[model samples]
Target: MFLTPAERIADYQARGWWEEIGVDALLRQAVAERGATLALVDPLNRKTLDGCAPERLSWNELDARVDAMAAALIALGLERDDVICAQLPNTVDAVILFLAVARLGLIISPIVMQYREHELGHILSLTDARAFVTVPTFHGHDYAAMAAALIAERPGMMLLTMGAAPHGADLRALAASADPASVAPWCAAHPVAGGEVLTICWTSGTEARPKGVPRDHNHWVLNAKVIVWGTGMQPGDVLLNPFPLVNIASIGGLMLPWLEVRGTMVLHHPFDLSVFLKQIEAEHVTYTIAPPAVLTALLKQPQIAASVDLSSLRAIGSGSAPLTPWLIEGWAETHGIEICNIFGSNEGMALMSSPIDVPDRTERAHYFPRFGAEGVDWDSPVSAVMRTRLVDPETGAIITEPGRPGEMHISGGTVISGYWRSPELNGASFDGEWFRTGDLFEIAGDGALSRFYRFVGRSKEIIVRGGVNISPAEIDELLVSLPGVREAASVGIPDSDLGERIAVAVVVDDGITPPDVAAVGAHLAAAGVAVFKRPERLVVLSALPRNAMNKVVRADLRAAVLAALES
Candidate 1:
């Protein structure tokens, strides 16, 4: 039965299933029911530390802004299904832009600000984006110059610059002037259907090209329901999302859940541990999605412990990386916040979450359910909403029982339909039905999947520098073509800022010593490698790290190379 938005929320609340409704209905309901309440708070501080303060906007204000923006965008020729790429930081504009685009049923393509031409070009080409909304400057560089360059290359695209405008760009001020009264009729005339595509988020990886994953209102809405239920979000709760908006956890777990519940969202431009804790106290934040690193830093800050009041914090949903038990247990002991470890990918969210029915406790083992060959296969019918299986690494044959670890595969409503424009990849990813997750794991006993599955690492030779996939084979081929290199092994070394740094371990032809970083840059530039894929660090080893069969043991090389850098 198709229950109305009110009915769905009422029913779910009554059944203690506060997490089962769609986010679209939830947003619509909030506008109808909680329009007078402050739904989102943007930070007014300069893009720097120490000056952050809350700038609250009520649901009514937000709704009007979104409608006006949607109308202005439509007036500028953005159509229903047309893609609008957003490459801004976490700001009020970013949040409102997404809402405005969704309101009109237009597809939003959000990319991170860090991405230079290489990453940006792929997404622009793939999504066939009709327009791009961005800032004139961020962190120092003139983004206006970048956008102008891109416009010169792709003349068909439109541009909307926030705060400042370059030549041949429409100012975002057009949105501010659009009469809400006029936009109301426009929104009423163009209601978004549940299954219409809402966004196309490009997947981040280091190996192959990025894939554009299309998500509809229904998919996101349902995922919101699940996250709300799983995380125990309340209507008046304040959700602090520290994760980048580019990833699904921020979109599905934080943004959608808060909108679905008519809760308040506290936005910070970027992750600053001390400022985050301070905001938690100042805004009375009730929930947040922070990785373990954020948690660890918060615990170590004496100012956070002494100056802030975190009593209102109820839950902290951590993702983007795995959480160690120490991080979870430490925070639970100190702050009384529940640590729910979520395992997800660019594809979609997978499991190993804490049960919502129970109270938050630090019984370590009870936190993440264990599932593997010893107990039950996670791919069984019980986990029908999301399916997973352990397959033989070599043969790709399904492993039916519980005791063995193999490659993990998933197929469900939440997974992306397929990669954009990659017919060959689409052929390999879909086995007539399931999308291959490309991860390796073991199932556990008690039918609960273990969260501690080993990352045997990428199936391909790609350097995962942070979440960006840099193909080593692609880099190696390029490096060897350079004038004086004998051989090269492209490997990723752990770096504090970038999750990983691509390092080329070169074998110099007998006479040549190690080349400096600048020379390495020249070689990569000459080879025409992507900017992010080029080696940020280089190492000259007498011989390449290899296994008994003479195959380069990239993993061992990465560890050794990183250890040397750290030393």
Candidate 2:
């Protein structure tokens, strides 16, 4: 099931960037050395998320449960190389089941719990997964019933639920009934390899249908190194993860890093302030990645942030949206916590900004060490192994000059060779071994700082006002930096005179008077924003339209803005 060519695998292994070992080997190493250490902690509100109490497991206990779960899957007729699709919350069972599937050389495709029939149906048809794992209900959604309906459409696909289920086998009960060591012999006989594909995670698909991105275990391990080196994670450091494990942000940044460091992994349901604060205090968490909005909220409301002792956190990672320079500086000066900016995709682009790489707070907020590019060098060892290039999208020529935005193309042990089962996407996305990231970036530094990349905006999301090209993300970040602005999204609205005009929808902070539309214009002018880049229309909304992944759906937003202006 490994998509990597034999030559590529041999090359990476020879270069010492990858190994012949699988994920199970890493777990075994941790279990053998730190069997008594706490390895996994479920979300504190797991009972509210699912219908069962939360469970914590030490390394030894986790390994034993993985075996039992693997045995249960085998009993249900799952075999090596079989694809297992899971849609569960951030719970101990989800983590354990992923490991158990990996131990048997099975490929897992985990989707967000927010996905329903349309998304799940497409994934099932594409992957032909043998098993579907989920919970019966979470956040008032009948996920198990959704899984049952989807599985019914695909015959022979077994359904396994973490909670009591009327539609499928109870995975928890099955694992409990099985012998803890029952799958040891089978695992030994099969013997997994790191080059084999371990998972197929899907893209956020804010614009279109999702595309599946597949990566071998070695590739994931290599990507995890970015987090390890960037955050200075050490053995036994506590990591509180709120990112959904369905994607690279969690799998590479938190899960694999936790395993590599033999650390305790504390799982949190996404965006639960009380649960998150409590876990950080009680678990003594040293590292975590937080949502961009949550970070901004804490910065705006000082009393809520001051209530907790944040001295334990050494660093925090943030992505998905741009960070205001003040947010990064605020966390550092106020709490002494360095906020590392992580820029990556499910398609294997890894660029991290850490205190070690980019120490200045404002620099960390906007710049990423240009790892893998020629002439530009960085302290991180990842720079030595990967190769990066920025190319003009229209001309197809390599871009070397600073301040000119271009599409990023990267090739390395961490990059995926191609998308799963999509010939069209593979053709459009790959130039030989280089994966074309639709992200637009420019070289933004001087002297030693010259080796840095500044995110402009997604190529598809750029706004062309009259003849001038504008990055909406640039304006969005500027708008968010202004006081009274909370959550902001900018979109291009069609105009008869100009091709498109910039329009912004903003959500103001609670209990504060909303900033006047004139104040917004004045703030942008003071920041020196160009006239073409300034918002032609502004709307104050209670909330912006968001997709399942919490990404602002710019298309929907544009429609909303146009409708409001028309009315």
Candidate 3:
């Protein structure tokens, strides 16, 4: 169901958080103004995926493809509000399909490339999707066979394959068959409202089954505004996007911003540092988004740093983990690029520390000045639209004092009403209008107006040793500062005497020996970390286990540590 209520829609529109125009309207405007400009550049397709030349589409060309696809979908009997599940990679076809869905007023559900039978089956069953779009094969997985098996269970579902139509209809043929002259008339007849649900994106499912998050055009537009304002994005900026297209990071962080600015977007699927760096140099990318771990790794490689021409990059947005101070400062000092610490979720909670807002590199690593803080306001467009607060988990009291950890709660135009079609999750996910973020944060700074907040790990992730509660983020932050440590994650392991003991898993830099547990403890002690909070056990690996979003899976790390301990 669509989240924004009628009254809320009126309010947001009145306040400029949302405009009356939809995303298609924006794209149309871009075509009218800058039709000849390069809208999308897909280099991955040239080198890896298709073995063809790189694909570059201008606004005019992209618009035509979108219309052709829309006409094709309409001809296939998919009407307004029909659901289409797309399991494609970051390719031109995926982009065209999304625009077509929006144009035809159909609900587009983008599944991550990593989803296998179990997850895809659950989503297909839940959505009762009328049409499924996928590649014949991706990364050696036979998707055509998989789609054939899935449609065998639900015979009504239509299968549309990108490469070949071994399972069902070929999408390439469908798009080619459609008459572009009839597309505008078809779209005009089936216009989508700004408040209509446009997408159903699934969560990462770290804790439980992935929940579908339905977002409207307004929700997406508002989120894009937040990213644009927070990141200080300018018109005609060149952005190198390596994030997957299924989530808010791609939609809000890259897609929306590109649409907003009418800029060039260079897409790189399956992130490769060498390729990503080459794109930055070749395309003269002005901005891009990366995980903190990737940024840290890039900064460590001297040859990579020297070889790549990063002069065009103005800023890099990073988060989804605790950003090390050294990494943030190092990028700024060495590469002359600012690292904007962005903390956001698929559920629409956003907190960013941009160089323009938080100039101090160390402060940028830890604090995000609460948007809409009382009596203090920045020039950000999202400042007046979004509200945030911290509340004590046990007492349910609002936290005003510094250094006390509390769960972050957010409310704004960007925040969705609830999970799609899941009443139980909807009931548990909100406290009145504010969405409970599940992330623990501590209020910092002095005075009511000057107060900011710092992320303090997740509520369920705190390690308890005896009776003392220790934040793994605090320990991880300290340990990452060690000389040879590339990545670090701390977890609690079972211990008979103390109930649980602090354990750390690290990915040491190549050619460097990992520090012993005692050495780690000594470093923490020297850094003034509490003895109770220090990690008692250490496990070294070549790399940390990361999800498709490039976020470290701590549950996996905990399990790996436990298995190692058992062995």
Candidate 4:
């Protein structure tokens, strides 16, 4: 359970970059000081999303829920170091589950609601989780049934559903039966430490099965600290979180930061623009994160954007890439809201382009503050502890000059030591002390501006559509498995509104009936692929372009598909 080395923990703690208090402690502090303040919220359309009414909980209310859930979990015979898999919508209940696990020294690996059996099976096998927590139904999907079938495969693994379930345990009923006051003794006896692993978030790359990324309490808290320092978040600031709370984009960036600042968290699962704007206006939100494409599309519609009052909002964060200079300036000039560019991954690659650092809206749209640079000081606290160097992927030579694209080597207090239990992946991912971020970046600007890092592209062939990372290899492998498909390649097509959309090109066998777009979509659907990962466009090719290794040339396929779609 102790993933970080003792020396590194001591080193970071001595440097004053990471705190001794864990997330559980942070929640306790918030409950102690801000007991009467509103601290958590359910999505506005909670009844439609999960068949439950919306909830607004103060700090004490949230604390009581956490205690009740923890006590219920303990009564069910769960113990320390047990891994729990959670698949729920963004709601107050989800946040309570997260805290309950942290309080009991348990590791929670949260997956997005989009995941089906194809994803859950692999995660359950990897974590060997003791339990699964989700609603009985979400978006009309029978999640309770899915959990029932999956849990049956592994004997002794329990299923806990938020709503009533015929086949599994009811989480709400269990919490209602348990006494919250009985949990304090158990928590004190268990004593969760800052270095113990708190969460194992999954990420996909070239591998078909997702890789588990384990983060200890100190690491996640440190990740949140970077967000707090960059944004200048103060106590009582309201945060509207629209991203999935599963990964770094939501958890590390917004959730933990909300705990740090003792603010009210407005939960939203994204893509509901009207509800999002409503929550912002109603909560008088001070900060929120949104996708660049969504923000851009909204900006184009002046009337829709004008419908809500965003005067309380000071700044908004959008994650890496797709941020045009005009997009940043448009929001600022029109609404007095600053758009901050955030560069990070679940593996703990952290960078932020805040107004205080870049000042110029144009530069802030594209560049992130280069942390840990010598002789170049930054206002952010993360800048002092992080060490970054751009290295040529082929030659292993470090590139310090501007305009050259190279793989980023990041070493810091919060960077993960390695992936969860994958020795081969760890060997490939970590170079001594530094984690190799497959995303390519360049050093930009002159003099003071030279302290900024610009994102050019990613070395990995992962398609990011609507801020969700999808591995093209997974799509390609699935496509080639279907009948008549001899070779298949998937690539991201640029979109004005979606950042990118999946496009596929297939070469069918001779004399075999070639599948059309509809047929291809049907095949993916039958295989339990997530809707977002399915191809938006499909093209038939006699032969896919390839190099000497015989691997499909994705670049060539992408160009052909783009032309075909345009035509």
| Cα lDDT of model 4 by residue, 1-567, tens digit | 798888888888999877866799999999999998899998888888877899999999999899999989999999999999999888888898999999999999999888888778889988999999998987778999988998999998999999788878899889989988879999879888888999999888766667899999998888777888887787889999987679998899899999999989999864588999998999999999887877887888889989989899999988745688899999999999998888888888878878877779888887877887655677677788788888999999988788899998899877899998899989988998899988898888678668888888878778878777888888887887777888888889887767788888888777888777788788888887778888888887777888999886777878888887888
Candidate 3 Cα misplacement greater than 4 A, ranges: 45-47, 50-52, 205-207, 374-376, 447-450, 460-567
TM accuracy, model 3 = 0.82
In model 3, the clashing pairs are none
Q: Write the per-residue lDDT of candidate 3 for residues 302-372, one digit (tens) a residue.
A: 67778989999999998766677898889988989999988887778788999888888988998887886
Residues forming the 10-long window of minimal summed lDDT in candidate 2: 202-211
Give each model a TM-score: 0.83, 0.83, 0.82, 0.97
lDDT of 2 by residue, 150-265 (tens): 78878899998886878898999999888756687888798888899999997732223456889898987787676798777877889999867888888998999998999899
Error of 4 at 396 (Å): 0.2
**What's the distance in Å from true for residue 49, model 1?**
10
Clashing pairs in 4: none
> Per-residue lDDT tens digits of candidate 1, residues 113-174?
76766567778888788988778777776667777777678878987777655654644678
lDDT of residue 31 for candidate 4: 95
Give candidate 2 misplaced runs (Cα > 4 Å).
205-207, 461-567
Residue 430 lDDT (model 1): 68
